[model samples]
Target: MESTHHQFYELFEQLGLPSSEQEICDFIDRHPLPGDVKITQAPFWTEQQAALLKELLKQDADWAVVVDHLNVALHH
Candidate 1:
């Protein structure tokens, strides 16, 4: 479990931040769904996104949405 935590954190660290909303959205659109996906796992990623968003966008729109954009960029 701890390894998984570090892995994800490292993943976010490597991703840095998204340049724009469209970049994020495009990434998300292209991202593939997990084989065993579930909504309950959503919140687990929120914290990571918020953390990255703070580092990247700073005083931008809602952190969650910014993170969503980032996710999009990362996936797509």
Candidate 2:
């Protein structure tokens, strides 16, 4: 399956993120399916994706963990 950052950028490009951070926030808030969550089947995801998703789901924390992952992916 594709990694979260790849999925994120794909959605970002699709949604035209340049409009505003609000747009990005709304997009993220909408909670697109992770590669693992098949609509008609059981869950499936790699260890890395699951771990990252766990962190991503932890809102109300000080830092933006999902953005951190995206940054790491971008640098690599």
Candidate 3:
């Protein structure tokens, strides 16, 4: 089966966050995650956002790649 690809900004949009490149950069800068913390467990996320992120990762859905990218970005 062919995989569906999604952009990093689209992940933010789906989470009801600012989707602009600058905004995404700002968000990551503001909410840096500790090395041990998972992105979905970040305090900055709402319940729905966390749930969506968990679901995407659990299912390895189309948004999973972007979600992983965001996770790495936050930890840095």
Candidate 4:
């Protein structure tokens, strides 16, 4: 099976968010994820955005790596 690699910025875009490098950094700085909270449960995400993240993670989809990257960034 062929898998498509996805970029971090593309995940933001898919979530209907600002996808620019600086914008992504700014967003991460603004929304720090608590150690106990899952990225999909972050209050900053809209219902649809959270659903997408959850679905992607659950399926181990192409966007999963980028989503995991975002999750790590928010936890910092």
Candidate 5:
């Protein structure tokens, strides 16, 4: 699971944020999913980030595998 978390590196880098695997984890820890909001809908995402997330899930893209890992992390 920790390794799967690193799969977000390319995404965070594309967003021009701290892109290290550890930094991404830290960010997730800092900005948790709101009770009523989906992880992809969390305000921390930019429009592009949101869309990418949706598209990844929609198409069952390779990234979607890691995104699903993240969704699980968000819940617990």
Candidate 6:
């Protein structure tokens, strides 16, 4: 199902983030990852946040698709 907002927007909601267009955009701008890092490996996240993201990916839970979309957005 195509999302009404950006895929990353859905991921943020599922992740319990700000979930606003401007906020998510600002977040990405503020926390850019290095060329070799994965979103899950980004340094900005606390251990709990990282674990949550990892769990989403590992479980392929309801939010996995959106999380994967976010991963791509962050990686590139």
Candidate 2 per-residue lDDT over residues 1-76, each given as its tens digit? 5433334544345323533557655644554555554322213334554454456445523234444454343333
lDDT of predicted model 4:
0.94
Off by over 4 Å in 2: 1-7, 10-42, 60-76
lDDT of each: 0.45, 0.43, 0.94, 0.94, 0.74, 0.75
TM-scores for all predictions = 0.28, 0.26, 0.95, 0.95, 0.72, 0.73
What tens digits encode model 3's per-residue C-alpha lDDT throughout 1-76?
9988999988999999999999999999999999999888999999999999999999988888899999999999
Which ranges in model 4 have alpha carbons more than 4 Å from their true place? none
State each candidate's clash count.
Answer: 3, 0, 0, 0, 0, 0
Error of 6 at 11 (Å): 3.3
lDDT of 4 by residue, 9-50 (tens): 899999999989999999999999899999999998999999
Deviation in Å, model 2, residue 24 alpha carbon: 17
Query: Per-residue lDDT for 24 in model 1?
Result: 45
RMSD of every prediction: 12.2, 12.7, 0.8, 0.7, 4.9, 3.7
Inter-residue clash pairs, candidate 1: 27-72, 27-76, 28-72
- What is the lDDT, from 0 to 100, of the residue 59 in candidate 4? 92
Clashing pairs in 6: none
